[model samples]
Target: MRLSIIRDAFDLVTKTQNLSSSKTDEVIDQIGLEIEIALGKMHNTEPGVDCKDVLNELMRNLLRIAPLSQMEGIQNELNVPLCEYKKILEKYFNPDISKAYRNFDIDTHTLNQIISKHFYREGLFDVGDHFVSVLGEPESAAIMKSPFLEMYQMLEAMKDRNLEPALNWAATNSDKLAQSKSDIVLKLHSMQFLKILQNGSIVETIDYGRTYLSPFTSTHKDHIQMLMACLMWIGKLDQSPYKALLLPSNWERLAEELKRQFCNLLGESYNSPLSVTLAAGVQVLPTILKFTNILVKKRQSMNHLPVPIDLGCEFQFHPIFVCPVSKYPATEDNPPMFAACGDVFCKQSILMMTRNGTRVFQCPYCPLDIDAAECRQLHF
Candidate 1:
């Protein structure tokens, strides 16, 4: 009888459409129930039994029956609000605000118009530019066929001004109906990004790379756009990876600007976590240098010189350390120079790019760069 129940649960999961939400929940719940019963049977078979063996057996069975979860794809899906996400997306395909309002609030049509107008004309493009970044193109046909696309169709109704159809679609696919929500939550951490410790969001940025593991559109434009969004967000918050903020300027000025912005954001209340450690030769600078050193050391293909030990030592001894002094000039006109438009990129970065046969140096911070041929002509 127990085996029959387990088999039935398996069949239910197997028969459901890949995009169906109901089957995801049913499969998980039924598997959980069977595991509990299996464990119960083991308990009843022996008086005061050591439950470890039974528990392990139950766990194995549960693992064997668990449905495949698109963990990364699901994580990307839940990161943004549904309506706002759909609305922002319309801008990329075209400038139409009609799609933006298709799912306008049934209870607040006027409000939906206001929100759509505000975003579509004002900030939706920027939002879509950023949003498409958070979740790349769907990885599977299952995802393209999922309720997410249904949400997109509902968005289409706004373009047609068909409020009834839009609202009906939204109603049928309510937020509460996302049965895979729990499975997604298990794999992601949801802390307010702004409220984390100073370095928190920087760490969160690493997970952005993981989204690529899911099969998505493999376009260079998409990758560059996603990187730009991450850099912009970090730059706005006065965050680190100092190289990311270089604009069309000298290294000194760029470094100074970043330092100023960081100080402004950190403010007086920041209590100088670095200073306290410096007074006693124990603190923030050393820890940061260690991290950077490890990252730098791990690169196998880098052609640029390493950061000097003296600099790391200085940071260790001092309470606070800012940008490194520029030892190299800022343009291709200078031998061993690398220019990206408004600013000179790191020598190491230039060396690496050159090694890869890349010629045109587009500065990450500002829009300044000669074409590959121009840069080559300038190269000594």
Candidate 2:
């Protein structure tokens, strides 16, 4: 309903503006025609043209039309809908987001770094530089900006179907990627091979695939076969069974994967850490405000949320382990531990069962006896 009101308001404004513009144009055309007729009559005179008569007639024509009043009326018409639109917007949106804010524990330097790095990550190099310069710590932020700058450059190159930069970066870090079980290098080579196949001879395509795409055959045999099968279709690969692989979406996915791998190589996450935090915070801020307004009105600190807030899966980095026995989430100080009997319990919970590691006890889920010393720490 609010958006419908806004649309209606803007529609009225546009209609009024068009009408006013048409009216003004018609009036101006009339005035111009009258002045031209007057000038023509004055110019065709047998004797000296009466300049005073022409000036008087032009003045009279302009006054009779009252162009200024008509313009003022048009201006008023435009302003009417504009004023109402502003009021409607202010009424419906209630955009005072400051109402949701609370002071949280973060130092000035940390905040500056986050803001500066976000600007750089977004490819706003000038903004980031100006910000860091004002902060008088430009040298500190220089190191963090270069990696993201290169990643964006590669992304831009890929936009133009140029893959050399990305391919070189992938080859340089192939060892790390292989250790992580990534086949993006092979995928890049396959894309390059496909490009060759699209415009070159079948023999040239085969030769390129042999030189570049052959190395991934051991691990990516099906993928390699798919590339080789394109040889049969050659210029008409769009009709082949592998046509789905020829989509622009394939390039988009490859670009995203390249960015992820690029960040990994830099020992950073695919998403900016500051972006993730703010995104998660945006989700939880409303609940925080609700509590602040009603339940926790006099709270001194917002270091920890007064209640649990479930954010979207994008914010979840790993599975949350809750101690089954205590029915509480396991924290780093009380991390979950795996028992030998294939059961898991929090370290504190396991300590309680084993009497602080002084005695052997039966597992809660199974009948097997277990000792706390035998329980291994679970990384997750």
Candidate 3:
């Protein structure tokens, strides 16, 4: 709808320009014709015709056909449509978004540091260094350089189909990966085996498998069997039963998995912090804008927004519990408690119903009756 309005305004401007051009041409043609006829009459009548009188007559004809006042009137009339268009647009204008930040308590220095770190995480080291230096904090650049630099180097190597750096990193962090139950090392080894099968001799491929693929056989037997089968069609693996093993997507998947595991080992999220925050903000901006409009209409302070904007499951990184009976959300202090029958309620509400843990109560959402002591605190 907004685009349509803008397009209509643009079309109107174009139409006005065309009309003005056509009107100007018409006036000029009329004046030219009148002057031509007057010139012919003067030439036929006498050779010594009064030039001043002809000029005056020509000016009068030009003024009558396209007067200055008439041109001004056309311009003024064209503005009327533009003014109406402006009014139409004003009706749909959103309230000033700056009003939403009237009470923001952000620290500029902290924000700058975050931005610098975000740039560093994205492998923009020069840009990050320049920012830190401009902010007069050269010492802080040391802290930002190491982790992301190593990560970026690993990613670069993976991009070139070189898994040596990634494999080394994975091997060094084996215990952490095992604790986290990550299969990134196995996946990387599989990728290495595929690379060998593609470019190396059959003997070399078998040797590579024995060294790397054997350990993962118990956990990934089917995949190891497929890799072993690829050796049969050494010269033509694309036509083998394990043809899917030669796909470029395997390398891509391995790279992604490697990055995820690397970040996991460092206790960082798989996605960059900046990306997650931006995605969440983009998802919630519309609801926030609508709520801001409501607050304006109600003449209320926009300092606090209504709870539970519902940005959908993707943006819900953490768990939220709402009491079925009270219809109120659970907090850390008063967490949701689950009954033996699998019903959940806020601690305060359940305590009230159980008479301060001195009696039993029926599950509000089920047929099971149980003592308050049986209700366990649920954690998300």
Q: TM per model? A: 0.17, 0.62, 0.65
Clashes of each: 10, 0, 0
TM-score of 1: 0.17
Candidate topping lDDT:
2
Instruction: Give lDDT tens digits, candidate 2, residues 1-380.
Output: 65698999989989998998898888889889888988888788667668787889889998887567877988899999989998987765546667666676879998898889888877899999999999999787779798888989999999998889988988888899999888788888888888888885888888888888888788789988888888999999889898987899999999999988877877778887888988887767656665555544675545445545679788888888778787667898999999889899899888788775476878878889987788899995
Cα lDDT for residue 36, candidate 2: 91
After superposing candidate 1 on the true structure, give the runs of residues whose Cα lies further than 4 Å from its correct spot: 1-18, 47-49, 67-88, 92-380
Q: What is the C-alpha lDDT of each candidate?
A: 0.40, 0.83, 0.80
lDDT of 1 by residue, 1-380 (tens): 53465455445444442434554566678787987797678758777766787788787877666634544344334433343334444422233323212232355544333333233322244553343344442232232233333434434543443334433432343343234221111111111122222244665554543432122234244533444344455635445343333232433342233233322332321123333334433332343344444655886432332443244453453232111333443343333333435343445555554565767655556666544443322232
Full ranking by lDDT: 2, 3, 1
Candidate 1 global CA lDDT score:
0.40
Clash count, candidate 2: 0
RMSD of 1: 30.6
- Report how far off residue 305 is in candidate 1 (Å): 56
